[model samples]
Target: MQIAKVRGTVVSTQKDPSLRGTKLLLLQLLDEEGHTLPEYEVAADSVGAGVDEWVLISRSGHAACRVQGNEDRPLDAVVVAIIDTIYLEKRQIYNKREQYR
Candidate 1:
């Protein structure tokens, strides 16, 4: 999973049948500090994420296509979770001990 920020919403009047009713969002990839990455993408929102929310993105083809219980969506990326917070150790976010320390 990669961290991303919701930048905007996608409004598609016509799309693939598998994508019907799915919420597409414009995501700007984010660093640990929530800074927007240079590149951005549009992702399917199965978890009801909102703009400005820090989210966990699932970029796996299988996982993204598994939305609505169908493994055939045209989706190449999707939002899987809304991150409440992420703990980091040093420059890497590998430790949660600081939360207790």
Candidate 2:
């Protein structure tokens, strides 16, 4: 599991049957300091997430489990949660937020 900001979205005209009808988004990977990292990749969205939205991303098989409570979503990255509020008290910590943006 990792926290990343949704940088952009991706659309696939042709994909595997398992991944059909799934929405994919390009995520701008973030480090602990909330700084954007150069490494970026696309993720499939189970929860509706938009661009520039801070979202919780699950990778590989873990991502498949988050959706439908079963490991069959055929996804490498899924938007399991969206951040609403982030409060860092110098040490960098998540405080409170639940808008699911």
TM-score versus the correct structure, for each prediction: 0.80, 0.74
**What would the per-residue lDDT of candidate 1 be over residues 13-99, giving only the tens digit for each residue?**
778887777788999997776667897889888788877777889887888877665477877898988777676755545223442
> Which candidate gets the maximum lDDT versus the true structure?
1
Error of 1 at 26 (Å): 0.5
Span of ten consecutive residues with least summed lDDT in model 1 = 91-100
Model 2 bad stretches (over 4 Å):
69-71, 89-101
- Model 1: residues >4 Å from true position, as ranges? 90-101
Top candidate by TM-score: 1
Q: What lDDT does each candidate get?
A: 0.78, 0.71
Tens digit of lDDT per residue, candidate 2, span 3-94? 78877777777777666677788998887667888878687776787877777777777646757734555566677787665656655354
State model 1's lDDT. 0.78
